[model samples]
Target: MTVSLPTISPEQQHALQAVLDEFGKTLPGCSLTVASDSNVLFDGRSGKFDALEEETDSPRAASKEDVLWFASTTKLITSVAYLQLVDQGTLTLDSDLSEYYPPLREATRRVFRGTDDQGQPIWEDSHTAVTLRMMLNQTSGFGMEFLEGVQGWKSYSGKGTGFVNSCKVDNLIHTPIVEQPGVQFQYGNSAEWLGLILPHIVNQSTEDYMQQHIFQPLGMRKTTFYPFGPEFKSRLMPLRFYDNEKREWQVLDQQMPGLTLPRSREEIEYPVAGGGIYSTSTDYTKLLQELLKLFRTSPNAYPKGALLSRESVQSLFQGSLPESAKGLLAHVMNMRPPQPGDAAATGEWDWSTGMVVWTPADGRRLGKDTAAKEGGWGRRASSVGWFGAAGTMYFIDPESNLTFVCTTQMLPGDHPSVSTMRNALEKQVYVSLQA
Candidate 1:
């Protein structure tokens, strides 16, 4: 399923190791690995898989194949499924969703005009319609209602209840686009809608469709939306995080919504497109390798039997946000009344289907030219950066045909250390490759 690269010189391998060796020093309880098309250049960890257990270090070092939540990287998989359906002509990006599904017509936009007499944020109606494309790119303009207690309805799927007051419904794809669609990118709960809609298109559950079409064909033995049975539990690593302030690793007691690690079948929530796929670095990389095939194949003709065609591959990766996305993100950062006074007044980041892409101007010191599409296409542009979450990060460098996946349960995901780890790894990786 994954392409294997030809052997490199021992000098190159040693250079690679030397770069990772320095990086291993920086992570006390984490795993770092790099892989090329043909071989794993490095697979080593300085910390235990169960970080909270002091006795579990060194001898219990993490492996590259250990099952961990890929977090939002799951979105890339979901996007692939959606794109596959698109390729099959099951759906169109710009079609009015409500026209196809009346339940979507039932949803409405809720704007926070200001606070009411009780001091809660006042809301108003927004008539903007939602679309499949907006859901995929996060530009449908939905906010994280769980954090703000937006008073949304709940779903009782027996697994658990999540606030479904999303622009999309809790267990349905009918929740209204509460914010103006196509205006700007805001984190929304459309992955559930994606999961919901894809099944509608193919008449198979999202999990089953993905399992049959993507996972089974790619030899992704360990990836799943939920527990298939007892064996699935055996390879799953426990959930834990490091407390920088306490200088210690602890079993994570305070978990976030949609977190699937170390939980029971009844305790897990429905697999949202944005999150909720338990996977290993190796298995997900296999999926990535499938995409890489699109780029590496001569591209004159579909690679005989490639899973997806070159045109769909280009469409999947080529859409980008408008010029207004940056300004809208900056406005949201500025308008947050409780934001720290010293916080930067501007923000930089955009969506590529389900992944977060960065441009050269976005401040990534890419060692080579990225040649990223600027716009004039759909809002689904691509970037050679990453799509990650509170516990994990995956980065792809198109110029070098390189990808790195870092898994950790670090909380408040935007922590300085996470960025530090990504930066250090990228810097070393480039240095090693050039050497």
Candidate 2:
């Protein structure tokens, strides 16, 4: 297929480079790549991936070729896999999810009211059927790994607050319906559940499933959910974070992730559907290009070699949060974009299948005002697609036909500096496109 790549004027290219330079000054390690419908407009890597080397007056420069931890950005990729199952007739999006995994069906019958005399969660049967659609939209009643240490979830996990590892449950977090499904949006566990189900239904681990279908088909040789294979360099941009109190950056010494290709692959206890992919901007961009073609092309004439069918692709962009879910989202006021100024542009977001869909306010423009069709930019007007975490972000702008993938390895996922750099970088992309 011939792709007419968008050409950035020389002035726009220089401006983009300056924007990257500004971020390099603030962030110790950062890399960014932006693409239009057909080609990469700007791909910049700067600063040092090794925070410790800074103290010794030497640092490994972040390179454009580096494959970083994808974190939650993997969600969008996994979302495509789920819809592929729908296209293959292996699973219906609306089918009772439990029809494939009997355990999920059994889980739906019970509700976690409180603890029993044995301190285990007491369950009462409920009639709610867990559906694939609900799981895709994050309405599944599942908790995330972060909830492991939270007091409330720990108590719910039946392990005391000091619990270090997963208790009796299969995954780190408990898997009962903490909240009623389809009533509102709950992330984290829904993707995990889907990740768990796919392997069971297909009798192949999701890592294998994705490689055979999404990765191999799309020519994404480096993208995977587990350890880097022997063909690939073992080096990954090490995870690091700024220690506010110590006023220094530190590398995170975390356990090697679960899904390794060979000897290390056995270490993977489970695939985290929500956040476990390891990839480069190049490999991931291929996936985004497929989605971009689906977004811009006619439904009847769907782009050839697209990951999902026309119906599934259309459904993906459609927001899943109902009006009733708005109030629940309101309580999440603690959420903020990476940069302080970006909260306005980025905060007016809604949950979609596996991405956050951005919208504008009524009377005022949200942060970065982009074009919309038919009317004022309301929730239904313009949209954004992404899932970000641990200093990694993949944002797709349907309006401008732009996609941004920024990767940095860091801990305490919500670090203001990490996001500050990301938000600034994103704002610059939109501004440059307006040129």
Candidate 3:
């Protein structure tokens, strides 16, 4: 299991360093890492650990080991955990989630309808069942309030209450189904519900169960559901915010200015299985490496391994969303922007179990001009992975045996600074490979 780290060329290092420097100037404070198969090709840090002046007046440079929130990236990890149970024959992928929890049956049969801000019918009902498959594929029609209804649901009081309630298999019976499950792609709170199911089926706390099944087996020492100990403070990256008016990035300070210091570990500890894991780039990379290995080894091919059966992995990569669902998710991701005299531009993409799969030529949608190489073809087309709300992203390309993890702490998800830094780093990495 000893992996020999790859040697990074000095030229590659310098190129990556230049990208980081440019990002630091644009982003309030940032850190990044680029890794090939076994070795970290490039690692760079700039700015403070905490963006707030009161937290620390001086800029705290980010470190390779800084533990940052993975946000939605947690979904991938949670999905893996569930698959482990499937490996043990303790769970079934296609089993109506309601079979285990009756309230979920409602989830399977519900239809969601809504009125537009202008009192016009925005979305109509498309009858479908929200199955476990749909939830995993994100085609369950569960809308993500974080991105869509951020303003209204931002103040929703019940943070983890839904998970707590849904943990009871019986709760599934009473749970209201909002939308037809299998028809449309909606990145809602489905993963959180799935995470809650883990504890119920395993009869253990989610953290303890995942610790034994995933973290321990994979040797992801720095990855955890909650802040484990003092190590968190040392590894935690400072949260930064973009001051659009000032046209500058700044550390988040509650007293001096800006909003509160976001949520603290003490305030929320359920370790939202959907989006609440904090991890270092090194630790999270281990998870990605294991997944790559899983694909390489071609294990049981279904939900029957610590990772996934090669076949299951392949199925997960296959686009699961129908045309309707694909269109819905594209809108939710803001992948399409309104153009003059035309409807919002939509691309041909589909949601897999835990990743986005692109068919041939889909790279153009993401603004890529060239097609990917054979082994590297998936880089711009078919791939699976997720990024955090705090500017962290990782992608695994089974076709190329490549995995990349980039970490930074930028607040207000999708800040322009974070996007700029990520795009710059990704472009350099691709350029280096071509060279």
lDDT of 2 by residue, 1-62 (tens): 23345556779878877876776654644777788767878777777766667756566777
lDDT of 3 by residue, 312-389 (tens): 556655676777776775665454211212122344456776766554442432334345444231255565666677
- Residue 287, candidate 3: C-alpha displacement in angstroms: 1.4
- Where model 3 places Cα greater than 4 Å from the true spot, the runs are 1-8, 26-29, 53-58, 106-109, 112-129, 146-175, 246-266, 298-306, 334-347, 361-366, 370-378
Best by TM-score: 2
Summed backbone clashes in each candidate are 14, 7, 23
Relative to the unseen true structure, what is the Cα RMSD of model 1? 6.6
Can you tell me which runs of candidate 1 are displaced by over 4 Å? Answer: 1-29, 32-46, 56-59, 98-103, 109-115, 118-127, 146-176, 255-262, 296-299, 328-349, 361-364, 367-382
lDDT of 3: 0.60
Ranking by lDDT: 2, 3, 1
Q: Which is the winner by TM-score between candidate 2 and candidate 3?
A: 2
Badly placed stretches (over 4 Å) of model 2 are 1-6, 26-29, 114-124, 144-169, 172-174, 253-264, 330-334, 338-348, 361-365, 368-381
